[model samples]
Target chain A: MEHLLPLAAALPLVAAALLPAVAWRRPDAAWGWAVAVGAGLLGIVGLLLRRLLQDGPFSYAVGGWAPPWGIELRFDALSAFSLGIALVGVAVLVFSGRYAQAAVPPQRRAWYYSLLLVNLGGLVGFACAADLFNLFVCMELVSVSSYALVAAGGGRIAALAAFKYLVAGAVSSLLVLFAVGILHALTGSLNMADVALRLADVEARGPVLLALGALTAGFMVKAALFPLHLWLPDAHASAPSPVSAVLSALVVKLGVLGLARVLPLFAGLDWLVLAPLHEGLAWLGAIAIVAGALAALLQEDLKLMLAYSTVSNIGYIVLGLGLATPLAMTGGLVHVFYHALIKATLFLAAGAIIHQAGFRTLRDLRGVGRAMPWTGVALSLGVLAIVGLPPTAGFLGKWYLLLGALEAGRPGFAVALLAGALLIFVYYLRILNAFYFRAPLREQILAVREAPLSMLLPVMALALLCLLGGLFGSGPVALAALAAARLAGGG
Target chain B: MRRLLTALALAIVGAVMLAGLAGLPRPGDPAAPVHTHVAAHIVAHGVEDTGSRNLVTAVLLAYRAYDTFGEVVVIFAALAAVMVVLAPAAAPPPGKTAPPPSPAPAVAPSPVVGFVIRLLAPFIAAFAALVLWHGEALPGGGFQAGVILGALLVLLSVVMGRGLEQPLVPAAAARWLQAAGPLAFAAAMLIGLAGAGAVLGLPAEPAWGRHAVLLLLELGIGLGGAAIILGLYLQMRGH
Candidate 1:
């Protein structure tokens, strides 16, 4: 069980390789194998979490090389938590294979699953990696796989969206590489921990600050920070449902995690140099919160509206980080986990509704609640969570964040948080009203039925988790508090 | 459209040439106050720390191995993406027989061009091998060698036509090989873990283990690089 950490990363990769071979011979075996692999991943993640909590951080050295020389995998509390979110997301997505098969042709289905698994493996690996280079490799793996996955459905628009994503991703990679190079040149190391140790003094230098700036900017773009979020809506909305769920849920969070990791590395730099940057990030977060909610409100297409909502939710996480207090950082980290689960649930439910009902627009979905009660119920719960209603995980994150903002004496940010919550309520209420109160669009309603149990099972499980997470928020809060302290150089 | 593509290609090439020329630093001339210290640090510790005879490989594989790893993954990812996005469309129904392969239009290649390609193939292959084998002691490494091999394949494809090229390396095999590169590196890293109790672990007998690991990792890199380049080339050709 202890030795399983490496296999958690390896299994999906190996399964990815084996998928094409299986599809080549037995096409039916592809989905079965993908499901099995997803199940295996969940099992592995469960085991890893047990080990992580019981035995502290787990480290695996690749190629028998020690730190500062060999690549390393570290499963600390933070990483394990993130990996849990990603693997659980993959598990839920596995249930969507039937829909994917029906929507995409048999020939493309294998490739889609292959890309999906590879992307999943990449995200998991990125979370666990201790080496800077390994993180970069994993980041690219997720990025490149996601681009292909986004375009796999084969439309001219999908292709164009993919191309844009590729260009943006490429630019981000270049920036990251440039930052890594400069850091390596400065510290003579590629190990994140080693670099941190060596860079304690050197981070005050102009070039080091420049490198940090580039890295932060690159990660900010990847996270779809408000002003830089231009590519996100098109990429998410145009992609197939499963792909959209993964993109909104997991891929963007990688950028947020990268920012968190790099922030601590620049600890001792003059606050004046960082002050403007922090303020800028906070301002962007506020704007993104308002803008995303407004944009979502205006969107007629169901998926695009959800996509914009993701951009908005991400703003809260970033805002928590920018506050830079211990409580705020913990809130930010907790949001990463809570948001991944909640957002994935919401997106999956939305996908299920779209697939069954063919409701592309909000107006088209009139009184869908009466037809598909389970999906509607799950969606309503997800929306309630997103709106920061009490006893929901979303509320806990916001509560912590609002408290942190108040603690940091940022009353303005607290106001933004309050406004954002109200906006979420309004939009979600609009969705609820359309689903439950309005008259049914008869033709669309007739086509709708309860989503497949496989799909509903994952959605319901996650929806229930939104409640569980809020009820038992202390466990994650404790872990996050520890990680935040470590990140702030106190631990 | 052809003219526009040609113009765009030429502009990109021209810009690259200008950057290359403009960015070249003068030999032994310290450009900045910081360069003096950096130069001294490199001179003092570079050779001793990195076992590679070639300073570039030492810098690439040893000093900055992480960047190289990232680069390798990036290329692999690009290839995987291309494969996923452009997988062959569904086969026609059973009752509908597929159309026959298009007849090759014989446009005569220039005799001089054919001669150059034929003459260059073996030497290019040899040079690529040399670069790969002597990477630790030369200006070139796996990436450069892989590119060279890919360039040779391109030359062969251009001279011999697509049919012959397909036989040399089939699409399926190319995809497998591309995947094999990173997997191979990962395998080598895993092996390192077994020997030294960690991935990317250099054994206590650094000379033997490091050399073996480097060679194995490079082989993966070469295969991956060649396959990805070929895959992209084929995708562009609408294969």
Candidate 2:
């Protein structure tokens, strides 16, 4: 069980390698293998959660090496919580196995699954990495795999989207690497703890600040923070549904987590200078929330609408982090988890709809709810969550975030949060209205069948969890609070 | 074509000017005198810091490993992008099919060019190996070694038809090798971590372990570099 932590990271990676080889021989088996791997990851994450709850934190030295000298695999509450979110997201993505088989050509399916698995492995490795170099390598693993996955959609637009994503991702990676190099130069260490320990005596504020700026800028780009989010809509909209699910759900969270890692490192810096950065970030997040929702409302294409919604939701996470209260941090962390589930479910349901109907525009989806009831219900639940309605995880995250903002005496941010929530309601309700109220545009609605159980099961499971997460929010909230505390340099 | 040549010429001249401003020194003999302050500083300080005999290896492997990593990733990103862009939209045509033959008249390889490539291949390989092995004690290291390997392959591709070379270095294999190199470097860092308590943060070790770790890391770099260059070549050939 203790060893399962490393296995959680290794399993998907090993599976990725094995997938291409075996997939050529047995195409049918590939989906099954991917689902099985997803299930295994869920199980591993569950075990890790149990262990984390029982123990304080877990550390594994890969190949039995010590820290600052060897690669250390650390699993504290923060990592375990993030890993859980990733696992849930992966499980939702596995729902696409059926949709993919039905929609995509057979030959492309194997590479798609391989990229997803590789992305999963990279993220898991990122969550557990205690070394800076390992983090960068894992980040690249995730980035390159994501770019390929985005391009795998097999369209001219998809290729262009991939190119945009590649360029942005490369620039972000270079910035991150530059920061890591500076950190190494300043501290003569590549280990996170070692760097932290060494920075106590370093008076070279200029370079340190530069490194922080670079890291922040790079991560903001990756996280699609407002003005730096140019590449995101195209990449997300043009990507296949499963890839969209994973990208919006888990990949962006990696950037947020990177920010979390860097925040503690710079805690000792002058708050006056840092205050502006946070204020700007908060403003960006608020604007993004409004801008993303407005943009989403204007979109005819369902996928593009969802992509903008992602940008908006990311704003909530960053806004909460910017608020800098314990409660806000908790909200941010919990949003990372809740958003993964909600977004993945919605994306999966959307994929299912697209697979069955071959329609992508919201107007084209009129009366789809009647045609595919289960998918409709799952999608509706996902919408409710995103809209921050009751008895769903989405509401609880916003509730905490808004409360944190108020508690921090930033009524302006509180208003922004409320406005963002209202905008989400407007857009999400539009989706629901289009699905349920509008007349059927296609005559084939009578013959339309439900998505395969493989797809429906994961969506329903996630939707149910979303409800359960809101109702039983205390457990995760407490865990996230603890994790946030740890991240804030608490014991 | 004329405009393009003029633009290229202007770009080269501008680059040279910028390099001059940066006080860039000319590539020279190892034992030759370096008159410039920067060159002298590099020669004097680089050996102690990097423990390499080849000044180029010293700078690449240690002083500027971060830039080297970026260069490697750029090549890798290019390869990945090409594969994604060019992967068949439908099932690939079956059999070991060649691209439709070019209509251009065949020009015989220059006798001098053939002789030069044949002459340089072994010497280049030997020099690359020397650079890699003596990286800690000299200026040349993994990056230079990799460049040399790429240059050799380019020579081969020029002398031989792309079709013949394509079989020897398949695109897929190049992709794998490209991926494997960074993975290998990462693995070595992980291995080094086993002794030091952190990945890539190797301890002041049992002298042997330190050397072993560096060698392994360099090997990963070489493997990744060679594969990436090969992948690029294949892509450029539109294989």
Report the lDDT tens digits of candidate 2 across residue range B1-239: 99999999989855743443232123353422232322455567765543455676544544434324434543455455455455445654678354443232167688888888888889988887887777666665666677787777767776765542344476455545665544554565455456655434344567666567667657766766776676566555644
Q: Which residue segments of model 1 deviate by more than 4 Å?
A: A1-10, A58-61, A70-72, A203-205, A270-273, B1-71, B88-123, B136-141, B163-167, B203-210
lDDT of 1: 0.75
lDDT of 1 by residue, A225-303 (tens): 8888888999999888878888988899888888877776676544425657677787888888989999999988888
lDDT of 1 by residue, B83-156 (tens): 66775556547786433343453676788998998998899999988888888776776888889988888767
Instruction: Give the winner by TM-score.
Output: 1
The C-alpha TM-scores of every prediction are 0.86, 0.80
lDDT of 2: 0.73
Instruction: Give the winner by DockQ.
Output: 1
